[model samples]
Target: MTSQKLSIINISYKNDESVRVLTAVLSKWFSNPKTLHFTSPNLKYPFNINHWISTFYNEDNIETYILKDENWIIGHISVKIDENKNLAHLFHLFIDNENRQKGYAKKLIRYVEKHIIAGKDNIKAINLNCVKKNIPAITLYQSIGFQILKEKKWLKMIKYIDKK
Candidate 1:
């Protein structure tokens, strides 16, 4: 389950080719029960990819990233940055079934955190929320220096970063 060449590519709002590539990967991933259950349990299996893409475009502060292993898109994550709050919220983190438990999720999260810390001096913390029952996800977050800040239907977690 070890991957040597992993890439995290940001999906640009102005790039049609990137959108098409992501849509194609998501179209197949969205059909799998594992992906659907982990992503949007309330929504039906055949989720609306177009609607999802539209929302990604509608948000000015949100940046979507795709994880690729040797050209195959295996995971996705997004971050919503708030300058006023000085916080970057990470969400929509999903790794394909085949790529799970191989340390890719942590790598992606760390990459994004470093990217944000490097890109902005005002971003003081990174945040994310996960379902209460997702123990593996919670453990992964904890292992990566994220702390549980609050708990409810969705557990709120935060990791404060020091930019040097």
Candidate 2:
């Protein structure tokens, strides 16, 4: 099978429609209690756009990204950079259910690594957390050089990019 080309677009308030669609996609997937608990433990069921906006959009340092293949947005991720700590934290990474196992997640991750983590000289590492039961995500992160920080209910992983 041929690979699809993907682009990561930084989400903004102007892209209201895109965010709404993304929210819909998220709501659909998170309807499963297990999926919802894994991705967003604090979030309530039946994900709403208003709550999503209030949770993710209000922070200045956190930037949401949409992964698009051609004109279709098939994935989403959010990054929050801590300049003081020289760290970037990845949160709420999701690929549309219909589009999984297609390398979209890897492309999105590499985009973040190149443009966000490695692009900034001071950034020391990128960190993310996943449910321990989520083996696919753990495997993907490991393949991309992330190592488990410690064993816990939520597995924390880090990929260090700064050589200095």
lDDT assessment of candidate 2: 0.81
Q: What's the lDDT for candidate 1?
A: 0.81
TM-score of candidate 2 on Cα atoms, chains taken together: 0.87
Candidate 1 least-lDDT 10 residues: 34-43
Report, for every candidate in turn, its global Cα lDDT versus the true structure: 0.81, 0.81
* Per-residue accuracy of model 2 over 2-77 as CA lDDT, tens digit each: 3476678988644777666776667777878777777776678766667877876677888778887777778888
lDDT of 1 at 101: 92
How much is the lDDT of residue 114 in candidate 2?
78
Model 1, range 31-91, lDDT digits (tens) per residue? 7765666665545667676777674557788888888887788888888999899999898
The deviation in Å at residue 15 for candidate 2 is: 4.9
Q: Kindly report which residue pairs in candidate 1 clash with one another.
A: none
TM-score of 1: 0.86
